[model samples]
Target: MRDVIEGFLTFQQEIYPNRLELFKKLAEAQSPKALFISCSDSRVVLEMLTQQGPGDLFVIRNAGNIVPPYGPEPGGVTATVEYAVAALHVTDIVVMGHSNCGAMKAIAAGQPLDNMPAVSHWLRYSDSAKAVNEAREYGSADEKLNALVHDNVYAQIANLKTHPTVALALDQGQLDLHGWVYDIEAGVIDALDGPSRTFVPLAENTKVSALSTKLG
Candidate 1:
């Protein structure tokens, strides 16, 4: 706790001064480039990893990085997506999963969430991901975990499309969707290559092969 306070002090006294002009501009309004959805793991710092600062990415972080299908059940994730697209007009939506994700591991192993009813219910959104990983052949636990992490990104992207705002933007060729898996140990990211149905490095000239990309 003290460390966090000190870090904030450093940012306010040193870092903020250097970026005061940028902060002044951001204070008036924000027009972020993309909607970044990722797991709420302490290890995954979205800004640090993407080399982005404030006003660059609108973010949503949850236990599994889950996005429940757009429907009667309203949630913060759904609302955020709508506003980011319809109002903020973010051009891209990135659903990211990471290495050794606890939620994915639990789902892959069929670990009982009996003690955590709410968690179990929430994770149902990623049930399809578990099914995909289980149906495939993996030689070891790590491989299975990796597959689950990647599969969840796909599942959530499908869910994102269920939003009317996302659907319309995609149909009009105004939006792009991305699925990514981050390797914590290696500090590398693998982005989904939609056309090839594979994960490839996220870099310049690289494109995501997902519904939004296909439609856009």
Candidate 2:
């Protein structure tokens, strides 16, 4: 707690002053470039990862970075997605998973979650991802974990499409969706390539194959 306070004090006194004009302009309104959805893990400092400053990336951090399919009753994620797309007009949405993600690790391992009922309920949103990984075979524990992480990212991207606002923006070619898995130790991001349906280095996954990039 003391560290958090001192961190804030440092930002308030020194860091904030350096970007005061940018902060002042941001105080009026925001026009973020992207919607970044990722795990609520302390190691995942997205601002540093993307090198994006204030008002650049509208973010949603949750366990497993899950986005449940849009339902008749809207939830926090659904509402946030709607606002980012319809109101803020973000052009890109990224669903990022990470290596050694506790949530995905639990879901893939099917670890008992009885004591943590709320966590179990929340993780159900990624059940489809678990099912997908289960359908395939892997040689080792690391392979299984890696597959699940990428699968969960893809699953969330599918869920994003189910949202009406996201769907509309996509149909009009105004928005793009990306799936990525950050390797903690390697300090690299593997992005999903739509053409190949494979995870490749971020730089290699250059083109975004949107709705039109499908086979008949």
Candidate 3:
């Protein structure tokens, strides 16, 4: 708690002043173009990874980076998505999954969650990912984890599409969806292509350039 407080104090004293002009501009309004969804992992710092500053990415984070299919039961993830699409009108939604995700590990290992009911319930959102892993013919644990991470990203993208606002925006060609897997060890991001239905290096996709421009 003290560390966090000092971190904020340091930000206010030093970082805020360095970006005062940008902060002042954002004080008026924001027009961020991308909704970045990722795990609540300490290593997955979206802003630092993308080199984005204040008012850049509208980010939604949770365990496993999961997005449950839209339902009548209200939840924070759903509400955030609704606001990002219906209100903010973000042009793209990027669902990022990273290597060595603790949530995914727990899900894959079927670790007894008797003491962590909420975590067990939240991870149900990745049932599709589990099914994908079970059906794969991978020989090693690393390969299985990699496949699970990528498949989970794809599954969450499909789940994101289930949102009415996202559906409308996509149908109107006003929004784009992306699935990304970040290799934490290698410091690389592989983006999934909707049309090709395959993961490719982020640099190989010219759409990332357009997204940068839109976000800027």
Candidate 4:
């Protein structure tokens, strides 16, 4: 807590003044270009990773970076998706999962979440990702965990489409969807390639953005 306060103090003294103009503009309104949904991992800093400034992204974070299928359940994820699409008019939605995600590892190992019932229940949204891992034959736990991380991103992107706002925007070609996996150790990002249907170095892929537009 002391460290957090020190960080805030530093931000207030050094960072805030440097970006004062940006902050003032943001205070009025935000018109972000992308909606970034990623896991609630301290290591995964979306703003730093994307090199995006104050109003560049509208973000949503949660355990396992999961987005439940649209239905009766009331959740912040559902509301954020709807607002980003219908109200904010964000053009792109990026669902990103990181390597060695704790949530994915726990489920892959069948670790008991008996003490954390809420966490266990929330992770049910990622059951599809677990099923995908089960169908594959992996040689190691790490491999299986990585597969779940990637699969979960895809699963959430599908879930995003289930929302009426997302569905309508997609139908009208006003929105694009992306699936990404960030390698923590390597500090690299792998994006889903539409043509090859495989994860590839994001820098090597020029077709991803264009492909997303077409998929809309």
C-alpha lDDT of all candidate models, in order: 0.89, 0.88, 0.86, 0.87
Kindly indicate the candidate among 2 and 3 with the higher TM-score.
2
lDDT of 2 by residue, 105-186 (tens): 9987889999999889899989888999999999998899999999998888888889999888877878888888899999
Q: List the residue pairs that clash in candidate 4.
A: none
- The lowest-lDDT stretch of 10 consecutive residues in candidate 2 is 207-216
Q: Which of the two, 1 or 2, has more lDDT?
A: 1
lDDT of 3 by residue, 16-79 (tens): 9998999899999998979999999999999999998789899999999999999964568999
State, as a TM-score between 0 and 1, how close model 3 is to the true structure.
0.91
* Ranked candidates (lDDT, high to low): 1, 2, 4, 3
lDDT of 4 by residue, 86-128 (tens): 8999998889999999999999999999999999999999988
Q: Give the distance in Å from residue 94's predicted Cα in candidate 1 to where it truly belongs.
A: 0.5
Candidate scoring better on lDDT of 2 and 4 = 2
Q: After superposition on all CA atoms, how large is the RMSD of candidate 4?
A: 1.8
Q: Could you give the candidate ranking by TM-score, starting with the highest? A: 1, 2, 4, 3
Pairs of colliding residues, candidate 3: none
RMSD of each: 1.6, 2.2, 3.6, 1.8
Give candidate 3 regions above 4 Å deviation: 208-216
Clash tally, candidates in order: 1, 0, 0, 0
- Which parts of model 4 have CA positions greater than 4 angstroms off? 209-216
Which one wins on lDDT?
Answer: 1
